[model samples]
Structures are given as structure tokens and as C-alpha cells.
Target: MRGWGDIPHFIHQSAGTLRNGPLVQFLNNIDITIMNKPADYSASEMKQISKRYTTVANQINRHRTNELKNQTIIFNLSESFANPNRVPGVKLKNNPIPNIEKIKKRTTSGIMLSSGYGGGTANIEYMALTGFAMCNFAQTLSTPYTQLVPYLRHNPSIIQSFNYAIAIHPYSSKFYDRGIDYPKFGFNKFFYLGNKKAPIIHQKKIGANSYLSDETAYDNTLNQLSRHPQGQFINLITMQNHLPYNHLYHHISHYKATVPANGTIAAQVENYAMGIHYTDQAVAKFIKEIDNIDRPITLVFYGDHLPGIYRNSMKKDGLKLHETDYFIYSNPAAQRLGAKNLTKHNHYVGPNDFIAMTA
Candidate 1:
């Protein structure tokens, strides 16, 4: 987990945009390179590599049994949705995410060990979609969407199992080069703010919040779902709970910290909690709506990473800071179709394992 402030440096050195330019030639001569070296393998070795990846892709494609083919799978990549109690010496007056807590008790829920602590959102998204871990990549490969996706010939992803696959993010599509990379990942369309193919249908936001609310995200998702009679795969990355948490909610819950902290950090935590509180309400409502639908549907919801607001408690929390809440929930209609069998009972997992665990 590196600071996002250093993204420009990573991009300048690793992005494929420099390909076929003098800069690349200069870097190559100096023993520095961004583009991956062409595979140095004999015909037999190439055949083996091809076979390995093909086997993995085939396994994933065949994992979704016929009974589960009609089930719509929605992956909700919630932003900065972490448990406040996990932070040392911090306590809230009331449970901020009671709805999520209740759902976790009944559903296949657990902790997801995230790749990034504060801001590696795209990497987690990549892991969930492609079933590839960031840890397996070179340490210099910080943002694969820019550094790797452009150069890859094929992208085998969970989306291949569905007839229709779309991505919904209530923010800029250009971030992390998603607009350019989504098609490569088998997505049919991307719905984001001002997207030309399919614009974001819902744009409602919370009080003083710069990002759209989870309610609106769900609304837009539901709208998209209504149009596709065939089961669809939706990758929804929410933005409501993103950074700059300053007193965004009308009703701010007071969080009493045993260890003294600055006023700004305290307010950020309170505002972030309130944000998740709204997400809880929205999630409960969304599930209720899914329950009433005739079609089978399953939602995989989890936070991308913990917010950067807890600088004070980072060292104390350690790896706990990289763990966020997640659950694999099937609607009653899907449960009746044995969608419940798709998930394993394991209580802890990594984002890279989600495709295999759920499919």
C-alpha cells in the first residue's frame, strides 16, 4: 500500500502510453523498462503457459452449474466501509451498521483481506473480476489497469459466465483507466457519470456530500437490471462513502475516542460512520426489493478498503486496517434454486478468491 500521491510517478514510468516512443527506447538502453518483455520461451514452454491459463479459465466457466446460470450476480464494491470498533480506543454511541450486522448473521459473511489499506481500490476490483491477486504481480505493477490491461491480449473474468455484463460506478469512468479497460474485461457497457453509451440514471447525493448516495446507486442498478431479461453481471463500485468525510450528514453521531485525537480526524470518522449508516439502510431496502422479484439474484457486497482518515490508529490496527466487511447473499428465489450452495462457509477470504468462492 503506497500513498496515492505517488500515482503520477508510477504512471509516468509504467503506463503503456509510452510505447513506440523515444522515451521507451531511452529507458530500455538505461536498463529501465515499462512494457513487459516479450515472452522468452520455446514453443513447448509457450504451449504449457497457454494450457495453464486455459485450464483456469475453463474451470471458472464450468464452475457455474446449470441451476445457477439464470441467477444474476451483482458485486457491490462499497467504498471505505470498515468497522469503526476495530480502531483502538474508539467507541460509538450506537451501532452505525446494524443492518449489515444483521445480514451478516444470516448470510455467508466474513472478513475480506484487502490488498490496499487506504486507497488501492482498482486493484481490489481487478482481483474480484479476474480472480488474480495483486500480490502475485511484480511489486512495481501498482496499477494494472494502466500498466498491464492495455498490453494483454485476453482477459478471462467472471463476466464471461454471464450473457450480459455491465459496470456501474457513480463517479468518473476515467479513473484508473476503467473506461478503456472494461471492454477488455468482457463488460458490455459501463454506466458512470456522463458516460456516452449509458449514462448514470440516478444522481442523488447525501447532505453536503460530493458523491452520489448508495440509494441512488441501487436505483440506477435496479433500472439497468429491469432492462436485461437475461441474467446480468453487474460490478457496482460506490462512491458515497469516499474521502473528505467532513460533516456530510445532517445528523452526526458522536464517536468518543479514549485516546486523544485531532478534531478533524474525529469528525471524519463520525461522518464516515453516518455514511455507512445510510448505506446500511439502502442495502436493507435493496435486498427487500430483490426478494420480491421473480428472478434469481445474488449480491456480493464488500468494501474496497478502509478510509485513510484513521492515520492515528494505523500502526495499532496493523493488518486489520486492510480487512473489510463482505457478504455473499442470495435472494429467496435464488436460494430456492440452490444458489446457497455456490458459496463456501469460510469466514475469511481475499478479493481474488471471490470469483471461485461465489461462482
Candidate 2:
């Protein structure tokens, strides 16, 4: 029968000679095992075994071919890793003193708006002007200047220009999809110095099974900072510290029992704390970048809205609910301009008031 005896000659031939004689002997034994089979085996049985073996061999061959292809592609891409031509040089020279003075001037009447998570009282527009006492830039502009409407108007031509603006709604992919077409708005010319696409600032959602990489987030933030510079205000809403958490404890196998009924509320708190730690690290890197830059930068950092983990859940975990909180970290320009004693107020503040207060 056409069985093990017909083991492909190419496979054996492709097996390279080993540097060690003993290893060669070991491979010979493997070849013998591949070749040898019981003569008494039925024709159907042999056929079934051969089919299974062939199926496995084909899968392995395809996998190996793909691996080689991927390796070659990676090697080629790596050659251009640090090539200067691949990375375009910045056209704008770093502006020094006036940039700082500009920030100071802006903050003299400027409002910085920051919002934490959740809907209702903590919405972005409401929080900016209400919670922070800043002006609503959106309200001043009509349909042509509205967030999604203008971008939808512009389309492909907007994409051609490097200038683009992206605003992400709290937790929706629809917003991002709409943002992809933002350049279509005629305002593209208004925002970009040249014909450029506007950049979108959005939030990231971290899943329970997901691994949080602060470095990746930092890289993304840096890339945004580099691209936008002074063109657009970049806002980042982070989910690193999001709650009702599950994935946070995946890394620690030992404490699986200690995690609460809903994955141990206390452990979840710790996980949330860890998430905040990673977020803080990311923010720290962002601050460093601003400090390094010669231009005056205003960075407002604060919570969108506090997580509502349920009163029962909190009691079960022996925790207490607290009022909403916000913090701002600004450049020396903002500070020198008298951005001081930004008090922590306890009230149901909305977005517009938030911006107005800060302004």
C-alpha cells in the first residue's frame, strides 16, 4: 500500500545535517519512526492515518511558510527603522518666549474645560462651561461649526490636507467613524495653517481581559502632541481607571479567592487604583513633553465623573462614596497669568460653567 514507505523524500532531504553526529543519529531514528508501520494494518486504516498525517503536514508547511514570509517582511521594514527619509522633518521651528507669553495672554480671559466620565451632569459641554466656568466654543458656532456636521460636509478633500479635528463622544464608535470624515467641513482651511487635516482627540476603553500598556498610550499622546502642536486642543479621556473591573486581577493568580463576589469590590478598588497609577504615569510623561517644549501649554487634568459602583457594592466592600473631583496642570505661562487657587467645589456643576470658571 502507499503508506509510510511513501514518506516524502523532499521532507527528509530538506532536513539539514546537524553539527553533532549524535543529533544526526537522533534525526535518523525519527525518520525510521516516520517510515515504519505495522504491515498487518488494514488498507482503510492506513488510508485514514495517512490522511490525518497529510492534513497535519500541510498545516505545518503553511504555518512555516507564513512565518518565513512574516520574518522577511519584518526584516525589510526594520532596515528603514531609523532612516531619516522615512521620518519627515518638522516644518515649523520651535517658537520660544512669545509662545509662553501667548499662553499667558490667552489665560487672561481663556477658560480651560475638563470633564470626568458618565452622562447627565458630567457631559463634556456642560462640564466645560458649568463645572469649570469656561466658554462653550461649540455654542458660539452654528451648524457649519458644529462637531460632526462640518466634518461631514468636507469629505475627501479634507482628508488630503494634514489638518483635521477629531472629537470623540464619551463611549461610542459612531463618533470616531463620523470623525474620520471631519475634514469635509469647510473650516479645514480655518484650522490648518496650510491645507491640513484636523486631528481627533478621543478616549480609550480598557477591557477586563486586556493588558494595559502605559508606554503605548504615552507614544500615542506624544504622536498627537507632535502632529497638532498649537493647531488644535487635544483632550484625552482615559479608561485606565475605569471600574466594575474584571481584567485587572487576571495578572495575580494567588488572590483569586480574595476578589469580591463581583470580583471582590476591594480588589477591584485596588485594580482601579493600579489603573490610575498607570494613567498618572502616562500624564507624567505628557507633562514632561510640555515642559520640554518652548511653547506655552495649558493642560487641564480632571475626572470626567466619579464611578458609580452602587452603594450596596461599596458597603459590601467597606468603602465610602465621595464627591466629584478635578485637577489642572498648566505651564508656567498659565501659572504666571494668575491661574491660581483653582478651588475644589462640591456642587452639581455642568460643562459650560466648568469652562467659564477656569476662563
Candidate 3:
């Protein structure tokens, strides 16, 4: 848990274009199919279908809005960004330990910041985020023993070792298409200008390196991170909740049931809930791993933003969108050792406020 301000020195770069990519194309198709139905359809039929879709969409949007609003409030309350006088809690061996000075000193020491849109944002956004985090962390640490290089070259082992060492979980890869660059170590960088519609591309993927899986891509990242043993903090961004609702839903159907009315709003809500449930399961696994770690570790897990499904629902329900929701769970080992029950910290907090709360 290095202090956010003390992160190591690192350069931040972005690549690729935002528009006309596979994701944008797919989203456009979905929008057209839903919003541009033939005008010739019977008014009664249209009314029935619209009512259902709108209902579901509205419910989702309301949920998202509420979540956003909550996050905003929490962010406002954080001392890290707003109030410097407020000290973050430090729990060692699970007790309400008063080492605020030590925590603050350790946090601000040698931290680096390399932020970009894609990787921190979602799966398709991975190319930018993962590459940047890895490169920056690597540059900071002295290299590990040279003998480990050969084992690191093995793709599967490389991926697993890197992730495990950094405490990054496997399911985090859902936000981006991993393995877009295999064999080679690079990211599928995408860029979008602030005022312009198109992207400025420099390097693009070619040859057999194009077909990488999310799992493998993550593995590659872990491999890269593992090269630096001196780098104490490795912050990872995951994309397990990115869109194409139906596709994401499929993976967690076991936790969900068919909607009663088939194409009705209630059904859509149920499906969305099911997807969230699956994400929860993934989070649970991460928590379990943290709890089992032999050394002291602080795990901070939270959503970057609420899912788009919830945004759509807000429109249908006519609710004003507001805050985002986040939760911070400590390792069970910390609890066992006398850590305060920080689970009660489950409240709406913005992304920026996270460092303050956990600092």
C-alpha cells in the first residue's frame, strides 16, 4: 500500500483510435436495432414491446444513478482529496493499530503514476492500461535474478506468476480483449482526441500475434510484472463487467433464471442481477486469496464505474443518475489478527477518494 503521491516516476502514453473499432461497431449495431424499428409495426405491438424494454432499461438506469450519486458523496467525504487532516486507518494483524504516521510515510514513498483511458476503463480498453501499468512498474524495480528469465518466457507460467505476485486476479481481464499481442510484449493501444472524432494510430498489431485470449494477455502482464522484485506496489485494473450484456450474462447464467415474461423489463433486470452475481463470485475469490496470503496485505476492490446497463435503465425509469457504489474488504487474516471490521465501510465512494480512505 504505497502512498498514491509517492508512486515512482513513470511516463504515461496512449495509442490507437477510439472510433470504428470492433467495440464501437458492435455498439452501433445494438443501438440501431433497438432504437430504429420499422414505423410500420402495429401501434399495439410497438406499445407492448416498448413498454417492456423501457421498463427494464429504466430500472437499470435508476440503479446506476443511485450508485453514482452514492459514490460522489463518499468521494466528497474523503480526507485524502478534500481534507488533509483526516488520517486513514492502519490495521496490522487485524487490530485497530495507531500507526498513522508510519502509514502516511510509507504511502507517499516512491509511488509512480501511469494512467490512461483504455486499461483502467474496460476489457477492450486493456491494451493501453495493462501495458502502461506493467511498463511503469518494471522501469521502477531492479531486475529479478537473470535465471528467472527463461521460466518467465513460458507464456502460461509467466502470466500466472505475474498476476499472483502482484495480487491481481484472473477475472479482471473481462474488460479488454487479452492476447491481442502474443509472443511479443505490447498492448493494443487505442487513442481518442478530446475534440476530434478519429484516433491517431502509430503502431498496430500484425502477424500471428493478433489472436490472444484475455487469460493469456493477463498472464503476459503478470510475467512482465514478475521481472521486478523491488517494485512493491502493482496496481491492476480489471474488466470483468464490461458490456454486450447477453454475452456477459451467458457466463453467469447458472446463477440466474429466465425472465418470467421473456422479452419483458423484469427479465432484463433479472439477467443484469445475475451478471452482477457472477462478478461478486469473482470478487469473493480474490478476497479469499488475500486472506490466505502469508504476509501482510491490504486488498482494495471497487468498481471503476457502474455498468452501462444501469445507465440505460435510468433512462427508462426516468430517474436522474447520481453516484457510484464501492466496497473495501480487508483480508480475513487481518481480521483474524485483530483488524477492525472495515466491511462496514461499504458505502458510495468515488474512484479518486479510494486512496484517501485506504491510505
Ranking by lDDT: 1, 2, 3
Question: Per-residue alpha-carbon lDDT of model 2 for 1-359, expressed as tens digits?
Answer: 12523322211222322222444434433422212245677889989999999998788667332221111000000000010111112111212113222333433222222232222222343234123232333332211112223324333221222233333222222222223323342223221112234332232434452533433444545565566554333334333444455556443222222222443244443344445444545555665676675544555444444444322343432212222333344556445544454444523343344333433
TM match of model 3 to true structure: 0.35
Model 3 residue 143 lDDT?
18
| TM-scores of all candidate predictions against the true structure | 0.84, 0.42, 0.35
lDDT per residue for candidate 1 within 69-147, as digits (tens), equals 4679999999888887776656677788899999998888889888787788888998999998877676656778767
Best-matching candidate per lDDT: 1
How far does residue 195 in candidate 1 sit from its true spot (Å)?
Answer: 1.8
- In candidate 1, position 117 carries an lDDT of 74
Residue 167 lDDT in candidate 3? 24
Where is model 3 more than 4 Å wrong at Cα?
Answer: 1-231, 247-271, 310-323, 332-346
Q: What's the lDDT for candidate 1? A: 0.79
Clashes of each: 0, 56, 37
- Candidate 2 weakest ten by summed lDDT: 72-81
- Looking at candidate 3, the ten consecutive residues that score lowest on lDDT are 72-81
lDDT of 3 at 52: 100
Reference-based TM-score, model 2:
0.42
Q: List model 3 lDDT by residue over 17-77, tens digit each.
A: 1324444433333322112245677889989999999998788667332221111011011
